[model samples]
Target: MERRGTRAAVRTATGTVRRPERTATDEDWPAACREAVLGGAGLLAALTALDGAAGSLDPLRGGLWAALAVTLFALLLPPRVTAGQGWLSARGPLRRRTVRTDRLVSVRWSEGIAQRLVLRDDTGRRLVLDPRVLLANPALWHLFATGARTAQASGALLCGATALRQLTERAEERTARTLLAGSGRA
Candidate 1:
């Protein structure tokens, strides 16, 4: 069934009207961007205030400080992720990457300061995104899971069943916790 308010209509080349596939995006992107901007501004303000009180504020120095703040902002900015019926995309400050989830060849988790979910498709396309985003957005998760299942069923997915299972278990646990807490039974 097609979801309401999620699809756009398109006219195909065969003179047919069809609903174009919908894409789910990271819903918390606005808040993340706001946090990035606030952090950059706060750092810039602190540096300026400190320099002004120390009698060291100058245009060249101020320019350099501003540049630093801008750099920090760019560095802190998270990639925007979007997913469709068969594809997922991550757009960063410099470029956008997409992978066909329905033709996936590999999936894995990269451990670091922040955990990242990495996906690769049969066409050699790759994308990496934060798993927290998927946990927070059901629509995005649904689309991604559907595509992953399709790939697995078609024998295209080879290396990521464990990763996907882990995520599914996590999501289930989180849901159970939320339900229990909401019902005052936690």
Candidate 2:
């Protein structure tokens, strides 16, 4: 049993057991970064080529284009996401936000130009991240789900079960697809 404002202990048949803390980060982050950088470089190259062909290429114009490319790269870069036993975090170029998954109060999907998963915990800590990060990294998803399950079992999670279920279904489907593809039957 758990009390309000107190951490609960998990007991097994033999004795109390604690979950080991482990961290999992998005494994595809490097590839995504490389893509962003390549995209920026490609844009800069194309613009410079066009400007030179039109005899308008100058140092100031080239510098401006370079700056524009850098800004585009920054905008295209994704946040780095990581999860541990009881917490999940997303670090963007500007800041990092983290939430205690084991003390989650709500989980919701925010639909927009880019869909995002929003997590809020009992302590008012919140984290927003792209759901694709979890789909791309199973280890991170495992850690996140483990903590969410603990919170649900302890009645700390008051909302977002449906959202979690939807994401779970997507993960399972993706796994099945991957298996089938690997077997040449997809």
TM-score per candidate: 0.88, 0.80
Given candidate 1, what's the lDDT at residue 27? 85
Q: Poorest 10 consecutive residues of model 2 by lDDT?
A: 1-10
Model 2, span 36-108: residue lDDT tens:
9999999999999999999999999999999999999999899889888799998987899999999999999
RMSD per model, one decimal: 2.8, 7.6
Model 1 reaches what TM-score against the true structure? 0.88
lDDT string, candidate 1, 32-74, tens digits:
8989999899889999999999999999989988998989898
Which candidate leads in TM-score?
A: 1
Q: What is the model-wide C-alpha lDDT for candidate 1? A: 0.87
> What shift in Å separates residue 168 of candidate 1 from its native position after superposition?
1.5
Off by over 4 Å in 2: 1-21, 110-113, 183-186
* Model 2, residue 55: C-alpha shift (Å): 2.8
